[model samples]
Target: MTTQGQRDPQPAGRRPDGRSERARRATRTLPAKALGWCVVVAVVAGGGWVVSRPHPGDWIPGLGPSSADATKTPPVVGNPLPPTDTDPEALTADRYFPAQRTIEMGGYKGKRNGARQGQDCAETLRARDVDPLHDTGCQGYVTVSFSGIDHPALLSSVTVLRFADDASAAKAAQALRAQENAAAALAFILPDTTAAPAPTAGAQQPRVEAVGHYLTVTASRLTETHSASPTAGASSPGVTAGASTAGQSAEQQIEAATRAVSYAAGAQFIWT
Candidate 1:
């Protein structure tokens, strides 16, 4: 007979606790095994959370504005005057501008001969280290100025130059692009032009475009401005100047004028 305090007899290959040795070992490690699995799950969940965190100024994770973008000027909006066609030779001062309250003296003029064209544009071309006539192969040009304008500043000019051939036009275009790129690389706070002027104050960001054998430039002087490069300058006679930038900034006006003039010149070529 067993005593009252004595345990039951063990089976073959069993522990003193009446369980198999393997079963006892497994039971003893259950809590540790469960804890290890919980740690693994938590680690995976934490890694996912870190990966999904939102970035600044952007919705996506791990993507944000670079230092360059932070320092760069915001994009500008250009003027809205519908681009109109003007005869390359007959272009007038009035046709080249955005129709301001009054005209500036000697602001609008045109040249037909290559020699005269070079002389007149010599100063401007020299500023960029480019020969107006020789480097550009420019045959003729019409110019509109904003001198003596009554506003925040004198800004608003257009120059339409015709080349002898398409080859000349293409070369001018390439040269202009190179100049603009160089100016940008220098980090100058001037207008975007085919080339930056020697003086930053009088310099402007002009929209230079080549369509057919004609190269057109549109520019606006700013009172201290900011703007984006226009993708396309859209204009219509029905679209009033006021509508273009009712609440816009000076930078916007400059951009609009730049693009509008290019579009107008290009359109005129097609129609005329």
Candidate 2:
């Protein structure tokens, strides 16, 4: 059992390859260290990838990258269009006139109408100590009339007025007015009054009447006058006389009147 040359095989507790047990253990630890370094490298690479990724709201400033990355330019605001008529009284009269009649009388009903109505309504609301822009319970009035003939037709109008009740309502009204104004302005700038027939010998002109309260606007026809007798036997008309295109159905006229009042009210608060 005791061999001096072999040193008793290193006492069986030591490694047989001429290294001590501690030395052999140290050699095995090297692999774990190498594995740890590999893990560290992998983690660094993953972090780099994450850092390089783009954020959802990221955008390039001025270089004009992809459209998605392009910077948003503010909308350009232009000057308001010039008034159609130089007559201050005529301009002021439009506020109290019917939209249909005004349109017929060489007045614009699109942008100009919207702008004028909006301004006038704003002034009225301000005079009443009401904040039209933010008040939803405000009320206003409008008036329309028809005249200039042996028979006269009038339409009085009223409506509830409010600022856009919500964001969606505001946006919708804004878009509608923008589109309507653009189309109306184009048509107004180059009017085609030639196509309109001249007033008949006894034909009537249209008119408007309006009144506003704190919470409601009431409109009514001033007076409707019809001639008693026709020329010969011109087939005595029924209840709906002289109401062709000029006089829309009662319901339609009411709807138009209501819209006009509401539009005027909305115009008051929209400009700011």
TM-score of each model, paired residue for residue: 0.39, 0.23
* Stretches of model 2 off by over 4 angstroms after superposition: 1-152, 159-223, 228-241
lDDT of 2: 0.32
Question: What lDDT score belongs to each candidate, Candidate 1 first?
Answer: 0.46, 0.32
Q: Candidate 2, residues 1-272: lDDT per residue as tens digits?
A: 77676555455657667888888888999999999999999999998777666543244332223564233221111122223232122222233332223222211122112211222233322123323223332222222222212212323222222222344334323332343222111111001111122222422212211122112232322222344422111223344333333435534543444345435533433332
Name the best candidate (by lDDT): 1
**Leading candidate by TM-score:** 1
- C-alpha RMSD by candidate, in order: 19.4, 19.4
